[model samples]
Structure formats: C-alpha cells, structure tokens
Target chain A: MTADLHTLTGAYALDALSPEEAREFARHLTECDVCTHEVAELRETAARLALAVAEVPPAALRARVMAAIPEVRQLPPPGRVADVVPLRGRAWRQRLPYLALAACLVGAAVAGGVAVNAEHDVDRQRTQAEQQASDLASLMAAPDAAYHTTAVHGGGNATVVSSVSQARTAFVYRDLPKLAGSHVYELWYSRKGSMVPAGLVDSGRPSGTAVLAGAASGADGVGLTVEPHGGSKQPTTSPLMLVSIAG
Target chain B: MRAAAREEQPGAPRPGALETLLDRVSRGDRDAFESVYTAVAGSVLGLVRRVLRDPAQSEEVTQEVLIEVWRSAARFDPGQGSAMAWIMMLAHRRAVDRVRSAQASADREHKAAVRDHSPAFDEVSEQVERRLEREQVRRCLGQLTELQRESVTLAYYRGFTYRETADLLGAALGTVKTRLRDGLIRLRDCLGVSV
Candidate 1:
C-alpha cells in the first residue's frame, strides 16, 4: 500500500491528485522522507515546466498588484520557542488549565494502558507531558493557526485549533458528557469516505484539551466518537460531533 | 538598492533573487515585493493562462498568486524548495483548483471534448522571452516515451487527474501513474535538479 502511495509523488507534485487524494498524500509526505524528497524535486521540475510556458502578462497587472499590496497584511514568521517566551506569563497562564488537563490525559493513558511497569509509566508520562506542552505552545503560536468550534451532540462545545502549515491540530473539549465504563473518546481525521483514528482520550473525561495524533493537514474534517478502550481500528460508533476544517 | 542592482542586469533574474526578495517581502518591504513581482509575474500568468485558457480568469489568478506570495512570504521555507518552485506551485495549484471547481458544475463530456482538441502542448507562448529555457524544456519533453510525455503533459499542463489522463489515453490507471512518475524522474534528471 505504501509503495502504491510512493508512486503518487509525481502525480502529487504535478497537482494531479483529487483533493482528497492530495490531502492523504500530503499527510503521507509528512512522514515519508523518500516521498518528501522526491515530491520536492518533482515540484522543481514542474516549476521548470512553468518557465517553459512563461508569457508576459498584461502590464496593468503590475499596477493592480502593487496597489493591492498595501491593504494586505503579511503573515508573521513561524513561532520560535524564544518568540513564545514573551507569551509565557499571560498566554501560558491562560493555557495552564488546558495543559494540566492534557497532562492528566497522558497520565491516565499511561496508567491505564501500561500497567505493567509503574516506574516506566511515570517516566513516559513526564516525557509526554513535556512534549504536549511544547507542541501546544508552538501550535497556538503558529501564524496560520485557526480555530473551529462545533457543538457536541450530547453536551457542550468542541474547538479545534488547526495549523495546516504545521501539520498539527490541538483540541479543546468543553462540557462533554461523561463517558461510562471502558468507552473512550477517539479522535478521527475524516477523509473522503473513511475515518482515520487520530488519537484516544481516557474515558469519562468530561472536558480537556489534547493534541490529536497524526498529521492534520488537508483533513476534510475532525470527528469524535465513543469507542472501546485502546480505541477502535475504525470508528465503531457514528461521530458525536463533526467539525469541518475548511473554515 | 538591491532591486536597482538587479535592474542593471538584463535577461533572467539573478539566481536567488526571488528568495532574497521573498525574505524582504516577509519583512514588509514593498520595493522587494515589486522586484519579486517583476521577476515572476510572467511565468505565473503564463502557467495560469495555459491551465485556465480564459485570459481574464488567468489574470485574476495570477494576481491572487502574487498577492499570496506577499501575504505568506514568511511561510516560504527555502529549505523546502526554491522560490521559483514555491511561486509556480502556488500558481499551478490555484489554476488547477479553479478549473476543477468549474468542472464540478459544467458538463464533463463537453469539458473532455474541449480538452481533446487542445494541442498536446500549445505553441510556447509567443510572449515568453526565455528562448533558451523554452528550447531546453521542449527538448527534454521530446525525449520521453509518447505515453510518458502524454501522461505528464495531460496532467501538468492540461490539469487532468491521473485517472482522467488514463481514461483519455485508453491506458490503465496504474500504467498512467507509473508513467507520470517515470516521466518526471526523466525530466528531473535532464533538468539537473536535485532535491
């Protein structure tokens, strides 16, 4: 299957994939070093083809484009760890609750899923907490990050902060109905006609913020479902809430 | 000042001018943006025109693409690709998106019929001033197998999906996919571009 996806680099670089396929391949590119390199080279080749067909545009385009530049706002550079430092006191304080909740989720997952070694779980939990904090910081500070909020069917609201350029997404759940038993909330990246498991949240947690697993770039939407512990290979229950990322 | 230095040189832009100009544009330098525009507008417009075929829409898209470069200049990571590749990718994707959106509403058969009659590659736009590049690209394209050449051109220049390209050429979908990859590998080698 991956080899088949590997061949998609040429078509992908040429802009020949269907939108859904393009998104899937883009997610693939984020993980596959070989595809990433090939796509870049092929894109360079495509750019050369553009040079072949280059034509002088109507001269008026220059005036219009220049006139339009002033009204447009340029995006800020990607967030650096140092750039995020200034926001640590206020912005970081504001995000403390979410961070704490995310840490709890990591703690719970490690405790419940890896009960074999208590010492190992503690170490893993600490590492994950640190990772999530940094990931959340950079994601929140991303220049292109956008927030999408949708009402959960059983309860309150779910907001997704997605940074496509960063290929990461973070989720904040508010007032979600408490799950019972071993059921957990599973995050999914809704592609064309299928749902891909993105991550799992500890069951019975009513509200929290956690970064969803996997590449979120080009996902059509994000969906949440109640699933058995450890999560399902595919969504076993219909999504309780579906948030379109197109916005 | 750098733009002035560039103005003294005739012909194609100096290597790395676009990248340098983009860095300036990201810092809100209008003069650098102009230099960037002057360097890339023709290629952006020409690519859009080839894909859209409608001159007015092509111009609008070219404007959008350039403005996008200005707005997202900070997003351009030189580590990922060259400035020209970044700009052209933006232009090509915008053109392909518009055409595909339009196709979603229009008659598919009519669209295919129109595409069928269009030349495999239109005469290199007479307005293209880069004669050496035009000839070099033409020569490299000429070296591909007929199937490989058609697959690449139909998808890249004509904005057809691989499945669509396969259907048009009466080839299997898998064959078209391989040909597109193989064809690009050949072009990449011929052009001497390394990732």
Candidate 2:
C-alpha cells in the first residue's frame, strides 16, 4: 500500500529541488492526503536534524549573516517574472507613457531576487554554522573527546575525567589499589540519610569512579561511601571524604 | 510586530560601512548598531577563518564581509528568507569570491581538504543559525542508502550539481537525478515534511 514512502520522505526533508520541481511537488502535497499526513512526520525528522547542531556561529558571523540576508534574499520568488504589479486600473494605463511601468517591473524583479537570495544565503550560513558547532560540541563530549580533564581530587590526587555530559558532570575519582581475593569496592553518594548508589566501581589501582557531579548550585557538600562487594542500593558505611562544593 | 522587529533587523546597503550604521547612529545610537555588528559577525569571521590561513588576510576578509553587510542592510527582504540566511550568503559569497580571486593555490588546497575537514571546533558561542542546526541530517543520513545519501550531501552541502555529482560518483546522469529525487523523498518521509 505504501509506494516507496521512504524515498519521498527524504526528498521532502532536504528541500533539495529545482524551484520548478519544488512547486510541482508543493501542488501535489496539497492534493494528496497521504502526502499531507506524511509531511507532518517527516518535518519532525527534519527539525530534529536542524537542531542537531545548535552551536552559535561566532559572534562576528552572526552580524555577517544578518547583514547579508537582505541582499542575498534577492532571489526571485518561485515563479515571479519581470512583470509590474499594476498600481491601479485607472492610474496604471495613464502613467504607462514613460515606460515607468516596465522599468519598475524589471527593477522590482531584480531587486526582489537579490532581496530574497540574501535572506536565503544568510539563513543557510547561520544554519550551517550552528550545525557545525553542535557537531563539534557532541564530539567534545564523546568518549573520544579531544578535551582532557585531569580532575584534581583530595590529597593532590588527579584523575582523568574521560567523559562528560552536557549537564557539565563527569565521572570523577582517583587511584585505589585493587582488592585482593573476594573483596570489591562499592561506590555510593550520600545526601540527607539517603545514599544513591551511582554504581559498583572497580578497585583497579588508579581507577576513576563517577561522582555526583560538581555540586548542587546552593548545596553544602557531597559524600561518598563504600560497601561490600557488588555494592547495595543503600549505603552501608561512612563516606571516604565529604567534598565541599564551591558556592 | 513585524515592523518593530524589522527596525531592529539590519540589511540595507549604503555608502561606507558606517553609512549602513548611520540609520542606527542617527538617533545617537552608535552602541545599538555596534551591538548588532558584534552579535552577527560569526559567519563572516568563520568564513574568513576557514578560507584564509593568514591571520591578517582573514581579518581583512572579515572586515569586508561585515562592511558589506552594513552597506546593504536597507534592502533586506524579510518575506523571502530569514535574516540569518541573508548574512551567511554575504559571507559565503565574499569567501568564495576571495577563493576565486586568490588565483589557485588556496582554492586547490581547500578543495583538497573539504572532505577531510571535520565540522568541528565551532563551539565558541550559543546562538547558532537555524539552517545549519540540523543534527538529524547527519544521523538520519545513516539510514539512507550509501549512494542516495552521498548523492544528496555531495550535491547540496558540497556544492555539486547533478552533472558534477554524476562525474564525481562515476554514475549516469539519470542515476544522479533518481538518487537525488528518491533520496530526498526518503529523507522527507523520514522527516515528515510537506514542502
């Protein structure tokens, strides 16, 4: 029943078309019930993509894009030609003596194209810039982030914060010797008689464990606890340290 | 509402770069246009950053893009495209013009590195333009057939027409069209768009 719905979906997402082609399809879109319905779905996909890279272009470039928009938007509309819009049926024919009507039409067409094109151009650049910035941001947060953070822990110990989320939190901890035999180190975050088990971290010498990230903006401090091997959901022991979060 | 917003939006061309700012400057408002200039300079500067290796040259290009933007602020048309597109096109055209005018060395180098150039290192700010903001394009791009995806990317983002795309991919002309059309269709479907 669905005749290659996927391909049409892709086409609509990118707006990759000659103007004429776009117009033809636009007409079909109005008439076809399936297409109208499908458009809504595909648009969501497009929006997600558009938002993928919301990185702000450099400050200076924002002005450039804005500045260029007027002129770049000078593109002629979908199918407008160099025909003048009549000012009035009576005022039009009478004033046609100086060829002003034709001249205005030509001027308007050229001006219009330039106007539209500028707008399109700046829009394109800004979008590309933002998209690129977002890409870079994600890359920085990825496991293979180019940024290296040697988070300084208590006792002058430093551990590499390998991963960070957009919320600006990183898994942080430092060197601890491997436990011998059946013993294992557990990780827990305690706050107000309630300890949230972040995870069961290894006792691999110099291993890093995820912490309860930085601190609550106005909170007093954070505490970490250790428990028996494989760790329980609740804290069973006192914290190794009560790190103070800066206000 | 549109008129009020339009007053804040700059896009006409006048005499000097300062001339464009004159409208804002007339009411003892130099600071306002300066704010505008500073806010939207990223695309212009970024273009210079990518195209010109020499810091001085890049600065010069950036200046030119900005100055031109100021000059042409009066003619902006809000109906056709958003303000962002207008500025980017100015920057892009200036950049491309510079690339073309620089003879061949820089052009050859950039073209060589286009694919290798990762769209990274641009996270300096938080107000990105909308057109380039689509992350789904890249992610969803994975869902497409290799040929279809490449066909669209190379043609649109990479600046190739069907003919050029055909030559580069070593496919037939018709194949390129079908790839573009069908790929777009699939993308639209995935995106759920009408236009």
Candidate 3:
C-alpha cells in the first residue's frame, strides 16, 4: 500500500487523482522528502506541458483580471504570527475544531461518499475556530489541509491532519489499545531516514489528541512505538504503527 | 541541470523576472502585479481553456487564477520550484477544480449524456506565442512510449483522474501510474528542469 502511494507523484502533480486520493497523497508528502522533490520536479514538467499548449487569451480578459486584483487581500507569508500554533496546549477545548474535523474524517473511512458534508463541516469549524484559536484555525483552514488514517498494530486508528504549507501535523488516537505498566506510546518523525522523538501519549488514555513536535515538512514518515514513561531518545521497540508517509 | 543557464528562448519571460515581479507583488506593488499578470495571462488562459473548453468559463478562470496569484503571492516559495511552475500549478489546479465541480453538478442532475468523453490529445493551437517551447515539448513528448504518452496527455491535458486515464487507455491502474511517473521523469530530464 505504501509503495503504491509513492508512485503517485506523477499522477498527483498532474492533478490526476480524485480529490480524496489527492488529499491523501498530499498528506503523505509532508513526511516524504523523496516524493516532495519528485512532485516539485514533476509539477514543473507538467507546467511545461501547459506552456506547450499556451494560447493568447482574448485581449479584454487582461483588463478584467487587473480590475479584480486590488479588491483581494494578499496572504501573510508562512511563519507570520498568524501561522504559528503551540505544538500542543494543555487546554484541550481549544482543539475542538481539530477534533470536529477529525470526526468528520473518521466518517470518511466508513463512507467515502460522505466527504462532501465533511468538507462543509470543516469549513464551518474553520469559521468558528478562527475567532478562538488562530493556530488550529489556520491549520484547519489551510488550502492544503489533508488527513490520513492508519490502523495501529495493537488496535484502533491513528488519524493525522497535516498542512505542508504550515509545516505542521495534528494527530488523534481513537480507541488505541492501552499499554500495561509504565509503557507509553511515543511519536517519532522519520526525518531524513532517522527517527526524531516528537511527543508521547499516556497509555491509560483510550483517546487523545496532540500536534507532533518539530516541523513536519520533508520528514520521510511518522512512527509510533512503545517506550518507557518519559520516552526514549530513540524508539526502543518495533513501531506498532509505522505510517509510510513517503510520497 | 542548471535551468538558469539554459539558452534564453525568445517570447519567454527572462529567467527570474517573474520571481522578482512576484516579490514586488508580495509587497503590495500594483505595478508589479500588472507586470505579473501580463507575463502569465496567456499561458494561464491557454491551459485553462484547454481543460475547460468553454471560452467564457476559461476567461473567468484565467481572471480568477491571476487574481489568485495576487492574493497568494506571499505564499509563493521560489526555493521549491520556478516562479513559472508555481503560477502554472495554481492555474492548472484551478482549471481542474472548475471542471471537477462542473462534473459533479452534471452528475447530480443525472445527466448521463453529459459524462466526460476523452477529447483528442495534442490539439496544436496556432496562437501559441512560444513556438520554441512548443517544439521542445513536442520533441520530448515524442520520445515517450505510446502508453506513457497517452497516460500523461489523457490526465494532464484532458483533466482525467488516473482511474479515468487508465480506463481511457485500457491499461491497469498500476501500469498507468508508472507510465505517468516514468514519462514525466523523462520529460523533466529532457526539458533540463533542475530539482
């Protein structure tokens, strides 16, 4: 499954995937450096194909485009204050919008056709969240916002919503099987083929939500492993949930 | 693979000119925005029109794409790709999105006859101002296997999803995906696109 996703770079760059599949591949891109590079080069190549067929528009179209420009507001660059959000705040209620988006996505796994309403739900949440938590709001509102869900080896599904433009990914664990003793679920981002510790979740919680530590852009994949309570410098056990986010 | 040092083609915007203009546009310079519009409008309209087929809708989408370039100029990251690539990606995505949405509306109306049929590929437009680019692209496309060529032209030029492309080509889904990737990789090298 993961290998198949990697080959999608060409189709993805050409906008040949269905919208849902495109979103899934885009989410994969956040962790896949190879895919990211391949997609960029492929998009450039496809754009050349666009140039090959280039035609001059009716002369009057230029006036219309220029007239419409001043009315639109330019977006602030990424990393502007408007784009930054805490990795994970203790105030979980501020994350309701993300959860709502996640819930709608959970529905998508069961019924793919229901994504249209999910999109509308996300839009509504985006508007509501904008006033409350600008960080989560901007992420949920990102034009490239995408979600990926995978089964944990032990139990339940791990759902992540990522915005490459924002360089952040938010994760939620649903019905994850609780571990025994002092063991905890530790998150690791496979950056450039090496595991970097991201965050940890308590084993007692059946469900939890948090944003991954560090920037997600260009990471190769995301992994979860059972580790000691405070977490290990590196994964001490095989990953129970290894998501090959490779492009 | 030094794309910057490639022989300058006539009628193409000079290397980095669009980037400089986009930088100024990002700073809210109206004159720079005008230059950016002039630099990109032809290709944007041409590409959108190819995907949409309706002249009026194509013009509207072209206007929307340029305005989008203005609205999102700050988001343009030159390190990832060239300014032309960035602008054309926005235009292509907008064009594809418009077609998909229109298709959805037609589907909702249960208009069976409105289903998308494969259009003829490589319909050369005589109005292309960049003959040099057209020739280069034509030459590179000519080098691909027939399957690879069909896979790419069906998806990129005709706005078909990969499954639809596979259906059109009567090939397996995996085969289409590989052909698209391999075909573009070959094209990228042939075009001297530096990653």
- Candidate 3 CAPRI classification by DockQ: incorrect
Candidate 3 docking DockQ: 0.22
Worst 10 residues of 2 chain A by lDDT: A106-115
lDDT tens per residue, model 3, A16-57 = 998899999999999998899899999989988887776755
**Residues B1-195 of candidate 3: C-alpha lDDT, one tens digit per residue:** 223312333322221146545755777877557646544666787788777776656778888899989998878876677778899999989878887896643533354233342242111111225555777899999999999999999888768889989998899999999999999999999988765
Per-residue lDDT value at A169 in model 3? 61
DockQ (C-alpha based) per candidate is 0.21, 0.10, 0.22
lDDT of 1 by residue, A134-228 (tens): 67656643434555545676876666666666688777665677777867888887654356678876444555567788887667567787777
TM-score (0 to 1) for chain B of model 3:
0.80
Residues B1-195 of candidate 1 have per-residue lDDT tens digits of 122322323322222246555766787877567656645777898788777876666778899999999999888776687778999999999888888886532533344334222222211121224555677789999999999999999998878899999999999999999999999999999988764
Q: What is the TM-score of each candidate against the true structure?
A: 0.55, 0.35, 0.55
lDDT minimum window of 10 residues, candidate 3 chain A: A83-92
Candidate 3 pairs with clashing backbones: A6-A247, A31-A219
What C-alpha lDDT do the candidate models reach, one value each? Answer: 0.70, 0.42, 0.67
Ranking by DockQ: 3, 1, 2
Clashes of 1: 0
